[model samples]
Target: MKRNICWIVLLLVLAGCSSPPPIPYEAPTLSFTLNLPDYADESVKNSELQDALVQRGLVLDRFGRIVPLDEGSCLYPIATRTALLKELEQYQSSSFGYTLVSLKKQGDDYFFFPNDSRSQTLESLTLSFDSVLFDLTSIDKGTLVRDWTTHFAYLDQTLLVTGEQHKLLKKKHLSFALRNILIVTGQRASTVGELSMQFVDAIDTTRFLVLTHGDVLRSCQALTQGTMISTPTEPYSRESIKSQVKLVSLLPADADFNQLKQQQSLLSTGRYLTYRGDIATLIDRCSAGQGQSNQALCHSKADDSSARKKKVIVFGGKHGA
Candidate 1:
């Protein structure tokens, strides 16, 4: 009986020494919806906007009832992860101060380099939408063991970001803007990962010339349909087609006066303005680039007021300028 007790004790000790099984990882799927108010104009509201969306095959729920647009805006959930990510990527790239970091997914893990020593596992990164806090504890240490190049990893899961969640994202975006850091997040194998990069070595700037009304007319006359620059306008009569014209801010490129003049001459034949600033500054100004009332506010901090009056043509790439 004493011998049997010793053997049982030994077995219990061995069992206690063994590591516990890892928590079952449930891959997360992120869902998103379109903010109807963001797409709505004065004329397109309530049932009218719903009907238009329905015509476009964006009916909501099962009953085919129109998605309400009240309380800020209503969102229509997007089905494909690819399309949702693409739109989110575009918004991040276009928004001032925010930049998307490239991530590599191998099997059930996603990885990205920190590019800065300050960033670490879950301490420096977080992904939250609305009240839901995603699980990031499933980090793969093999990424660190195999190579020190990858700074972080997360188990694959799907992440859903509804329109309500977007408000939270915008708040986080504002936080990033204030901190002067690049925060990027993506949904992968049932998981969402957020990475912050502290250092950026390069950014590329691309330029486009804004053509004036006369310049547009002149170009239309000389250029063929294929080469002509078309400007979209709102309709006053008949069926209204979507307008291609979009408002964007222009920043002057880092070039000599002569080069700027030469490019202006080549691209435009009418009066125009030049903008020269970083991405963050440009976005801050352009957010207010609507209505006559906001025009003054947009131009309040301009380097030159004369240039602010002219229409803007957006220029510059996302990173490395």
Candidate 2:
């Protein structure tokens, strides 16, 4: 049953450990743990716990820690073990502070290498996350190895870690969060005469890379497209995403349609992703070019989504070594 404010207040008053953890830092980790109030009685703890468990798709671990088990919304934990055990796998997911990040996985660890728009190849800057370090095989239903997505799934307030407790997370190179990031988006057309979306990485203005879905315009039409951008999954609200990512449109609100068609944009010139390497490249089954069309723009009406029309498999587009 959902707990009302009164009940929550009552629990806080009655519980031995009422203080909740600090808001979690936005980073990938082994897994996120839920904070449970130590009620004065087992009956109260058990009753209030169910609401958090089902809402966040969490289960109690042997340690009495609430964790995501068989969570469909977040597959980071089981995505690896369930896939045919390939020697190499790629994980593409939205990051906190970053628009999108892809960690290359070989065996058991995933890694992140921060690079600029000029990144020609994907490299590892830090070992971001890996599930193998934890031996969950002994825990009941904890058989699947876990990663950082569990805590970030829905901005679960119960997962925040404050005080010295933040040190508990094993996230490496925490300074990487301080890196400057830029959000770039542009238009690309498709073979079907549809203006399917694609990403543009401006090597000049861009200090580091991140993608905004459309830079959507009247001339833009994303029939069915997917790219590594600042788009969110179903569990996220635009407000929540906006809080962490900063997006700027290459095409301004007062952009001239004719000038855009003539290869002009707010960048004061055209910026295109003409890379043959890996990082943030496009699998864009789309033809390259831009110009706004009222008809085409209104069809899909401009969205910052990973995939337009449908949310299918979106790769990080990490090409070569």
Candidate 3:
């Protein structure tokens, strides 16, 4: 009888050891500040700026109400205005004016909308859970139907996450991590559009995830390619490779709207695989290629113009002769 009891106890212990750890729970609070130039007093620019600020999740009141802003009442949560004002005093830029509005976390369950307020909710979707993974696949598909502004394309379907994948991410020391793959299907109308996947750090509440859609796509292709190739010296037939090598090449080197839109069309249906890792590395990679492409486009455009001008001069001389 004692032997049976001991065996039962050992089984319970082993089962407990194999179970996943419980996720910590804490309701998230939202806070942010908007800065507008003081010169924006009742001007059309000022009104536009206010609208822009509100669009980026700065319209919550202390009572958790989404309200319109008055000229001086642009401050949300109203409690952090003094701190924001103090922080703004350190600004040295003398370029254009800015109006400063800051969001302060007043209570639990209040969430800020960084994207479109009309599409996103003002309350925390992850409420009542400390660490949870929210699946975005469905939400993204639905949003695409309602919002014509987004362009999406399918590169390939990948398993969302596996036990091994979760273990890999956890080994990298990320908590409260979430992952999703979103395809930019339609063409982007503007050159300024960017794809960013960021997660708010549970410890410090700082958001991190700096890779662009291009960066992520290239990384995925390279990794998958390397895995399929058996040797470094092996020659790859272009047709055998399933990767879209031309998609990312179309990203504009400059900020020309027409050129940007044209290039974005090429990115339509490109596959981007998402991964979670060290925040510092992601930030470094994002900053490294920030404007290099745009600058290259500018230089290329200059060269073309110079060549055209020389041609015009030569044609005029030939006609005069």
Candidate 4:
């Protein structure tokens, strides 16, 4: 997040005695002052009007971190209005805008409208406690979407989004999104994840895939404590192999391999499989067992080693590892 010291300085400049003088008061437990006047929207001062800004997580301090309390919300600086407007204009250079029309929120159910119009909605559809804001919509309703104008400093205007409904807004997706914005703003891919080790390459926004494993995993781990990311790699392959390929031995203890079997059946019927989605086939292909007892053992150390060698030769070492 970018910091604008101008807000603090502007507050100092404006601090002084009024005609009748102001009532003295201590700072609130939670407080924030806005740094940009033009964008802060003075109309927000109305006591009776309620804005979705807070619920949507739009409240921010000059430092760009979310302000948790009402007292922390402040107006953008009046002095910097011109500069703020200029920045906003630059941010709004693109003609496209997005309107997110969400379905009514129940206890925890979430839903979004599938529309071909420029507008789209993000629903909070969670099926289980582990589900993170998952939802679904028909693909035909997808339309062209762009980054939020209010978040320009954190993203770029050139970053385009394909119309698709997704359940998990995983950190990898957010990181890639940030990288696209930074690339458009001419900044180095701001290092993502807690440790800030994984750097995204901003060549084409559309071509950039999210980082879910390896360095990406390290980055996410660094950012938040007790966060575990899925790291199953290359589970399926279409190419016939003369040698074997390595599979991750450390599977999640509670992982639903049964759920995987269901997906595998779907893949066999017609669904596409990423390398991570082909676990059963990859294991079967790399093993030598024919009987139930032999298959229970799954593979031998020698087979595992051969598979690693084949993977290094076929998919290249960087990702195969």
Root-mean-square deviation (CA) per prediction: 30.5, 26.5, 31.8, 27.9
Q: What is the lDDT of candidate 2?
A: 0.26
TM-score of 4: 0.17
- lDDT per residue for candidate 2 within 1-321, as digits (tens), equals 456888888887878476665555443323322343331112445534433232322333333333232222221111112111121122222111112334333344433323423211121222233221111112222111133333122221112121122232223212212112112232322232222333323223432221223222211212212111112112222232232111121222222212222222212222322111111222111112332343244223324221222333433343232
**Model 4 alpha-carbon drift over 4 Å, by segment:** 1-180, 184-321
For model 4, give the 10-residue run with minimal summed lDDT.
74-83
lDDT of 3 by residue, 1-321 (tens): 999999999999999999978765544443333443332233453343333223322222222222222222221111111122222232112211121221222232212222223212222322322121222223333332333122112212111222333344346543332332212222222222232322212122232222122222222222232121111111122231232222112221111111223333333433122222111111111123546664454345433432311222121211111
Better of 1 and 2 by TM-score: 1
Per-residue lDDT of candidate 4, residues 1-321 (tens digit)? 124688776666677432445555433343333232222333444211112222221222322222222321211100011112232233232111111112322233323333433212231111111111111121221221122222222422223222231112232243334443212122323343222222222343443222222222222223332123222222233331211111122122112222334444443433422222333322332234435554443334323433322222232223111
At residue 319, candidate 2 shows an lDDT of 26
lDDT of 1: 0.27
Global lDDT of each candidate: 0.27, 0.26, 0.27, 0.26
Estimate, for each residue in 43-77, the C-alpha lDDT of model 1 and write its tens digit.
33334433333222222222222222231111111
Pick out the ten consecutive residues of candidate 2 with the lowest summed lDDT: 75-84
**How do the predictions measure up, each by TM-score?**
0.18, 0.17, 0.16, 0.17
Residue 275, model 1: lDDT of 17
Scored by lDDT, model 3 comes in at 0.27
